[model samples]
Every structure is written in C-alpha cells, then in structure tokens.
Target: LWGIPLLHTEGDERTDVILGKFLKARDFKVSQALAMLKNCVLWRKSFKADEILDEELGADFDGMAFMFGEDKEGHPVCYNVFGVLQDKDLYSKVFGDDAARFLRWRVQLQEKGVKMLKLEPSTPNALLQVIDLKNAPWPAKKVRSVLLKAISLLQDNYPELVIKNVFINVPWYYSAVFSLLSPFLTQHQKNKFVVTRLGKSTEALFKLISPEKVPIQYGGLGRAGDDEFSGADAPVTELPIKAGEKKTVELAVTTGGSSITWDLVVVGSEVSYGAEFQPDQEGGYTTIIEKTKKISAQLEEPIRNSFKASEPGKVVLSIDNSLSKKKKSVVYRHIVKAA
Candidate 1:
C-alpha cells in the first residue's frame, strides 16, 4: 500500500486533517506512507513533510509508491510507481555468470516464439535475486571476439543450432563493426540480430531476404516522363484515333523552331511502312492516307481488327529526323496477343 499528501492553494495542513485520521484508522501502514514519501523525493527531489501527506495519500492502498507536489508554476501533480517481486533462485539459473547457460536459455525462449526481452535498470536487484546474474566487465574492448568464441562452441556442440548476438542501444561507433560481422552470421543469426535504431537510414544497410525481393521493369530512351526527351528534337504531340480503330494509316508531322524534315516508319515482318515530310519553322505538315485510296482493303481490314480477334501480332511505330540524319526517334511496340 502507498500514500501521498495532497495540497490546496493555501498550502494549509488543516484542509484535510479529519480525512487523514479516518485514513490512518483504516489500517494504512506508516511504513507504506514513508515509502510514498521516498518515491516523491526520487521524482521531485524536495517536498514539505506536511504538504507531502496532504497531496499524495488515498484511502485504498496497494503495495506501491506515490508522489505529491506542484510544479514551479503551482500546478498540482501526483503519481504512483508500482513494484512486483519475483523468485530469486530462478534468476541465477537464467542470467548468471556463465555466458553458456544464458545463451542456452535465450535460445530456448526464442524457440518458444518470444519476440522481445526487456530489462529494467531499476529492477536489476529484483532480477538478480532470482538468478545468479552478473554483468560482463565494463569497458571491454574485444566483446565481439568473446562472443564469437561462445558462438563457435555452441555450433560445434549443438550442430543443429546457431547463435547470434543482438545488442540493443548500440552506440554509433560500433555500427561499422556490426557490418563487418554480418556476412559470417547465419540465417537464424540474421533473423535474431535486428538493429532497432536503423530508422530512415536502414534502407542503405539492410539486405533483402528472399521473400522480400521484387523484380523491376526497365524502360528505354524517349519514354514518357523522361527528361532526355525534351527540346525541339522531341516536341510534345498526340496521336488520336477512333475508339474501335486498331490503327491509323495516316501520319502528321509538327515542329517548332527551325525548319526540319522527319521520317515516320512502321516496322513489322508482314507489313513495313515509311514516309518523309519537311515542315517550315513553326509550321507542320499532314500526310493523309485517304484510307479508301492509299491502303488496300485487305491490309486496312487487318489494321482495323480488334485485339479480341487478333490472337498474335507485333507492330512497331517509329519517328525520326532526316535533316541531321539522326535516329532521334520514339519507338514503341505492341503485342496484340499473349505469348
């Protein structure tokens, strides 16, 4: 049980004097009250004896500590800290001086599917009471060397098991050393040693496991959204067609700035087509096929067919420059049928 003193604006002790006696009469232990005072000291570092009790204690007490007081701004504040006691002998067996024993128990816990382990700096004494726990020497320069020896011994004896060291709160200087040891670590080791502090920079360090890998598509020159396809050489243009038309037999050429001559071509095995047009500066030229005249009905029939009826066919559309004779063209291919 725990207790703390409450205070009012006046800081008067008599404000709850009657209530204090009723609380004490209810069998609240004095030692418990003192423990609450100790907790207040730990949190705030200072408190008046009278104000401490008035601001903190309550009638129903549990085995915990409490705090009492106001901040420098006079805002009321109070809180409680609870403690749990565990068995002592259990501690020694789990985290004792023998690193081998600790490693074994850690493996057992992981096999049971534990996700995380938490240790409190404040609760070390309680933990030590159950297990023969001991801290590794401080300022140790060769911690990895020692850990590697332990890992080798485990692997040699338990052929089916591998151990990995996972360090939490790693200071910045040791990150490079961790990278050096990564290649030697096994699959189980990699799974166990997750660096929690990677944050935004994690993408640069971590390698993708098989299940997480994905394939990427490659795009070529003069593609949409490409920066290199800018300027007069590749002017913005659109190709318009009817909803059901499979292809457009005619081609239109438009250019900005200086005069230029361009070549339009359709490259395919069954049918190949080409045309040349010269447009003056800021001018354009249109080449109409007059579908009824230029293209034969048999060829135009296939071009007008929908993808549903065409099981398999390939067609490439290209446009280039003829003035400089450069192959600065946009090429696109479409497969009408699944291969």
Candidate 2:
C-alpha cells in the first residue's frame, strides 16, 4: 500500500517479513493483524505519507529535522532539534490540529532513511535518530501528546526500524518528562536509547558515527551550512507561483562530484517537477530527472530528488504549474555537499 517494493530482512530468508511487522504489531493474531494492517494502510493512504518527500512543512520548521550521515553500521543518522519545536507554537503553525500531518512528516523521514539503507545492502535494517532536548519549551502534556502519536506509528508500522535513539543535551529537569515516556518504550528499545549532555565529552556520539561523518555542529567534519540543524537556524526559501508559470532554483556546485539535494511541495492538486545539471565545462545541459503527476486535491505531498555532479557546475530545480489554473505556493529545502 505504501508503494515500496517488498524488501528482505537480510539473514532472515522469510519472504513475509514485511508482513511480519503488522502481525507483530497485532500480537501475531491473524484477524487482528488484518484489521490493524488495513487501518494502517488506510491511515497512510489518507495522510499521503509517500508524498511529503523532504519539503518544509512550515516556514519556521524547515530544517528543524534532517539526515546527516550514517552510523558505524551504515544506518542513516537523523537529527531532530527538539529545542526548536515549541509544541504549541510550532505544531500549531505547521499542522493546525491535523495530527496525521504531523505524524506523516515523521514517517516520511523514516522512509527516507530506509531508502538510504537500500544503497548499502550490507547494512542492517535500522536507522539512528538523535533528538536534542536542550531547551525545549513545550509543557509535559503537549510533549506527551506528540510522543503518543509517534509511538503508535513507529511501534506499529515501522517496528525494529530504529536501532538507536540518542537524546542529546537534555536539560536537568528532563527526567520528569522522560518518566512519562518510559512506560511506552519496550525494554529492548530502552536498551538502545541514550540521553546525554556533551559536557566536553562527545565520546558517545563518536562511538556511533565517525567524526568525519558527524556534522561540524557536533564537533565533526560533516557540513550543514546555514541549516537549522546546524544550530544556525538558517532561513529557507518559499516560492509563490501562478498557473502556467515556472520557477528555477539553482545551487552552485564548485567541487567535482558534489551532491545537490532538493525538496519541494505543491500545496495544491498537481504540478510538473524536473531537475537538470548544468556542467561548468562548456557542455550542454543534462536532464537528470523529469517527473510530473496530478495528485488529487488532497495534497501532492513533497517531491525530493538529488544527483551528484561529475564536475563543478550548477544544479537547477524547475517546477511547472502550467496544467493547473490556480495560484500555488511551494516551500523548498535545499542541501549541497561534495560527497
């Protein structure tokens, strides 16, 4: 139902392993599994998890969360800035009481991690999520409410997908909040999670990821320039367009083989999206990707794509809304790196 092809669990030769997650979520009961599976699939369908891509859900929360690099086991490492999320203020602005929208964004991030793992077949079936709670402002009740929805979604549909959950720079009084969360976490999950303050010691983080792969914000060589995740709280671009109009967003790629990543969402029904590479050499333009779809008015979600340039040049992202007869606003998140 998610449109993802069936994937194996490595050493486990079970073809039904994907189905197993739903079954396990229902306690291995056949009828219960069916019911739960249907509901989960329906929920995802209505929420349009597949469409969120990596686009910014709101102007204020653009880079509050993102994927930096892989851990020692090659699992994708995701960082969540719990500090930037003022539950009432942020969530309200982004989701406006639509719980599914909030949950959908989180699920899409996990799916992006899974997609990354497919690049390294030898890697295990899991990802690492680091949430920093240094200066979170939400009250316990608001925090717990979001956690409840997260737990239900991750625990049920994406079982065993999160191998590590590192909570960093937790404030001294954070224990009170964690106590409420502990009941929902299984012993295995608890064992895989850690909460720590750097305090001149980043040993735990380095243990999971090589320093080179870690972001500079975390005392590592990884680069996240001007990103909100970089502790910089950088601003993201927002595009407004009319029907039959097109917009081009470009990023400079000075290093050969540097990667350019982009995320964009059409707030209305449908639009045309494409990506092209303009080489520094007097070479002609290359059409790396061309995709167009007309999703129902429900929401087209976000479209994400990336390509590694062979030489220094510019990567261009263009979206055409010529097919529609209405004005639309597109929020975009862009990242560049010489990977």
Candidate 3:
C-alpha cells in the first residue's frame, strides 16, 4: 500500500502499520481493512502506479508536481497544480483520455513525497500538501472529472499518506465540490484539511506552519518553484546574487518592433528589477522599465513584461539587489519574437 514493490505483510513492520491503520479506519474490522488493502493492491497494479516512479512512466509529469521543504510537523511538503491548471483540453490531450496514467501521476507525486520523507532523521508516515487554487475557475467537464478522480483515489486507497491538506485560496465554488469530495474522505481525513478562504490568511497558516517553511509569495520564508514559464526552445536560467549585486540578460532583437517577453523571480528577498532597450544606432540604452516593486521572497509570481524594440538592438533585463542584505536567486526566462 505504501508503493513497496512487494509488501511483506508477513512480519514487515510497515505492512503491519498499514493494516493497523486500515483496521482503525474501518472500525477495527479486519475483513473491511483487508478488503481495502487488497483493492488497493489490485488498483495499483491496474493503474501502473508501481511503475510511476520508473523513468519512462513518470517523465511527462516530472515538474507538474514537485516536492520541496517540510511542514512544521516535519512532514514533507508537496505542492500540486490542481489549483492553477491553465489548459485542461491541452492537458487532457498531453496525457490522453487514460485516467490510469493521470492517476499514476497522483500516486507518483505522493510516492515522491514518501521518498523525500525517508530523507528525514525519522521517516514521517504522512506528507503535507498545499493545493493552490489561484486563478482556478470551474473548468470543463474533463477538468472536473480529473479532480474528482484524483481526490477519490487518494482518499480511498491512500490512507493517511497526507497528514494535512492545506487548501490555499480555495474558491467558493469549491465548497460544493468539497461536499462531493467529503463522502470520499474519512472523518480522520476530513479533520486534517485546512481550508483558507482568503489567500492572504497568513496568520492561520502560520499557526500550523512556521514562517521559514512557508513560501515568501505565500507570506512565508520558504522558497519554492512558482509560476515560471519557459518554452522548449527558451529555457530558464538561474542566477545567484548577493546584496548590492546586479545582473543583466541580453536578448537579441534582430528586427525593429521585435518583442521581448520576460519572466523573472527573485528568491529570499525582493530586489529592484527592470528592463532596458539599447538601439543599434548611437541611440544608447533607454530604460524601458526601471522600477522596484515588492515581490515574494519564497516563491515568485512571475513578473512578466513584453516590450517591443524600437529598432534592431539589444534588450537587457536587469536585476538589482542593492536594497536587501540577503542574497537571492533569480529564475528567469525570456523570448524575443519578431513583430
């Protein structure tokens, strides 16, 4: 049940724990618990969940779900993208109509959390997950279907794998969906979910999680990968900068009116950042955007800007950390497109 290839239910302490939890979950009924466990094994086999950690099976979902730091309770932290799914149609197309593979992705994500937890001094029985729902509108039927499948699969088959489900900025429409999701959850699970209506409800989250482990974008100290967009051709570059440091990335604009699009995130602290346009002529560099704005220190909400060159020249996007004493890392991606 814990994704172990061959569960040694005979004398294996982990399997004993799983059996015990299932028994407890089902009112100490060995028959029901055993039934549940058997169903889980069968489901895993059919779903190809065991192979999810395998390279070929999991390659497509590598970055879709990621594991980072631990929660305040010392449980591994996982952030899933259910909340910010941009294109369900494209997503469905990429993964195809097979719910099994997608379900495998969910299992793989949780299993990845398990692998991370094993790195701790003492392995945790469960992991903490943050499901961001920002910009998540009620999507097409496919999206809803996938969400229901994921929730159901986790709640029923994977018991106590998630110590807590921290739902951030959940929309009002989600309450109805939660009502649907509730039946799938046991009372124990229902108790573990922490729902914050306002994304800015930092105080409540802090009560359970320490600031150091929370992402700065979410008003916490932890830094994590946020909404950074990179194309297959235009990959992102990572830059490290100390206080008072400056760095600029040069984008070649071969045609007049060519567009330069960029997204940058500074981890650990906010810094002044902007873009400059240098024309080919004696036109020198003109500050296209030179302003410092507050940004999250943990994760970044991509600060994106699209500026068209006035003439064939170089477009330089600069970051300045002169204002803060802490060092920070910047994740940046840029693309230059002809007008």
- lDDT (C-alpha) at residue 296 in model 3: 56
Tens digit of per-residue lDDT, candidate 1, span 191-303: 64544331211121112111011000101111224332234343322232222223332222232222222222111112223332333324444332212212211221112
- Decide which is better by lDDT, 1 or 3: 3
Per-candidate clashes come to 19, 2, 1
Which candidate comes out best when scored by lDDT?
Answer: 3
> Candidate 1's error at 262, in angstroms?
71
Candidate 1 vs candidate 2, lDDT winner: 2
Off-target runs (Cα >4 Å) in candidate 1 are 1-97, 111-142, 150-168, 186-193, 198-339
Is 2 or 3 the stronger prediction by lDDT? 3
Best by TM-score: 3
What digit string (tens of lDDT, one per residue) describes model 3 on residues 157-217?
7766677888877888878778877877778778888887754445455566655455555
Per-candidate local distance difference test: 0.28, 0.65, 0.67
Candidate 2: segments with Cα more than 4 A from true spot: 1-17, 20-38, 54-59, 86-100, 119-122, 198-201, 225-339
Model 2, 101-193: lDDT tens per residue?
666667777777767654223447577888877667654575567777777777766665677789887777777777877888767668877
Error of 2 at 207 (Å): 0.9
lDDT score at residue 304, model 2, on the 0-100 scale: 53
